[model samples]
Target: MTTFTDLNLCPELITTLKDLGYKQPTPVQAQAIPLVLAGHDLIAEAQTGTGKTASFALPMIDRLSRTPVEGEYHEIRGLILTPTRELAAQVGEHTLEYGRLLGMRVISIFGGVRFDNQIRKMKRGADILVATPGRLLDMLVQKKLSLAHLEMLVFDEADRMLDLGFIGEIRQLLAYMPEQRQTLLFSATLNDSVEVLADKLLREPKRVAIAARNSASQQVKQSVYAVDNGDKADVLSFLIHGGNWRQTLVFTRTKKRADQLTAELLEEGISAVAIHGDRTQRERTAALAAFTAGEVRVLVATDVAARGLDIDALPQVVNYDLPNQPEAYVHRIGRTGRAGQQGRAISLVAPDERRFLQDISALIGKPLQLQPVPILENGKLIEGGKLPEKKRNQSGKTRKGGANTKAASKAAKRAPLQPEEPVAPDTPGKRPSLFGR
Candidate 1:
């Protein structure tokens, strides 16, 4: 029964929430907002769709607005670092929305775009800055901005930042900011790496855990289809066609795999697009936009590229390939079943991926039941039996590498996702398009 008004947020935020049709604070918001407004460093563990952004943004805006900075040029008072460009853009959008009535200026900076416009925006001044670490560091080195006046620092998706190997960059960025600022770390899961970072950065932080650790959303009905690696494409096509899925997010482990899957889906007469690190910003943005607007039926993405995707009412998420890390499985399925909407998460597990599936199950503290793969033939849907056991050497043990290592190697070399021109360190701003348009 806790409401935004009861949480002691300012009237401007309350009005904005009402305008956005948000009646009550979500669990994380209700808990973390108060702590943030009270000027406490916090470590909040909440699921992706649990309003984690608002929990920090609303309170940060309120606190900053109460104490206006005295200067003709607005200095960056708040900084939020995200793992990927997509996430930075999404968080920037949300922050702008939440603080609009208060007249807060928010800007997002990431690589893959030219720096001229971003520098111009920074010169105009931003009250809150959302940026990916690499681009932000570039700006700092170039003397385009300063974080010395920052009053608050937030690490959104902290676990993801570490997963993307941004720890060193994060540390380097910290050296540029004032040490006295209030720091808030929000993540879906808090593993040991995150714990170490939190210990180093926060001072007697308040911990808010909105859900069980590494747990997938209950709203997501998770199931697995056991199949051979070679038959995965056919099974996926059968499922999509048989179920008549309109909007689906598919996760692949590698950029190469994402591209291959997307191509295969298109060849099957299914609308699909691939997004990954190798893609240019313009391409990534367009692909995401098309998928969001339902112009594309499926979006195939690697784990890094899909980190911060926010799709409303996404009905289905297909794990085209099981992730190497079990925690990523939770984050992948999280793309669907968001904001209390019922969703389905289906994983096509090859025999080699059974171990990966088991790791995922263990992390989530629940056993994922394996379902027989479905076959579509003559316009009929039928069970296709369990997956065959992994191939073993004559010694009766699973092969050390894989059965078709040579073939896999050849495929990887032949069809690698074409990498875009590298973003030159000095001219990062010249790239086309920002993420999350």
Candidate 2:
């Protein structure tokens, strides 16, 4: 029954929460806010939609509000590092929204945009800076900013940063900050590498674990359709249009697949857009906004582009292609079923991708409900459509009569891309998207 008001937050924050209709603190927020306010270097294992941004933002804002730094010149006091630009922008936007009345200045810095604008903002100095590692490092090297006055450092989504190869930059950034400052590390999972990073950065950190490590949100209803790889797009289009889905987020494996999927969806009369590393900042922002506003019904994204994307009330998430890494799958469906909301995640699994599905099931410790693909064929719903077998060409004829040929084909179907971690052997366990609108 603990509420935001009972958490000893500042009156401005309480009022703002009321205005924003956030009646009570989420589990992570309720537990983490007090620890942060107490000035503890903490490690919190929580996902994106658990109101985690507010958990740390509220306390940081409260402390900064109590003691406003005043001078013609401004020094950076708070720093938050995120893996993707989308997430950095989200954290920066939330900080400003919560701390706006307190006269706190916040800025988000990342690559893909012109540097002069960020440099101009840096000249003014931000009270709270949310940035990607590379751009922040660039600013540091150019002597455009200093962390000498930094009092708080937050590494939001630390595991994702490690996955994206920011460990060295993170270390370099940590070296510049004062060791005495409070550090808060938040991530969906605290794997061994994240633990090592926290050990080096935090000082006897108070640990707050909201869930078991590397598990998907319990609220998501996960299921998969066993279909042929060639039929994935047809199945995805059928589900969106046939099921009458609104505001679906689809995840694809590659940027090229994302772009192609978007085009395919559009051709099918679905309003879809693709967001990836190749998209300019403005395009990415516009695509996200359109999807959020329901102007676009579907948003197709790659694993990298989807990081730190906070879409509210997203009811469905589709995986057009299974991710190579099990952890990546966890983060993809995480886009929906957030903040205790009921959500559905569906994956299109080809015969070749069953092993990938097995890898995911092992990681999550549960088997996903498997159903045969239902297809619209010849003006009727067809269940378990048999895909056409390939004919023998030059390569197939070479091995056609070999005794081991059948076994070799089976082995090839079973072979999956190596996961970052060992694929758990197929055991009894819980079993276990898209480009554009």
Highest lDDT among the candidates is held by which one?
1
Model 1, total clashes:
5
Candidate 1 wrong stretches, greater than 4 Å: 375-437
Query: Which has the greatest TM-score?
Result: 1
lDDT of 1 by residue, 309-401 (tens): 989999999998888679989999998888889998999776667788899999999999676554444555444344435531111111232
- The list of candidate 2 runs beyond 4 A from truth reads 375-437
Clashes of 2: 17
- Residue 380 in candidate 2 has what lDDT? 46
lDDT for each residue of candidate 2 in 32-138, tens digit (9 for 90 to 100): 99999999999999876888899788898887777788886668888999999899999999999998777888999999899988999888788889999999999
Local error of candidate 1 at residue 31 (angstroms): 0.5
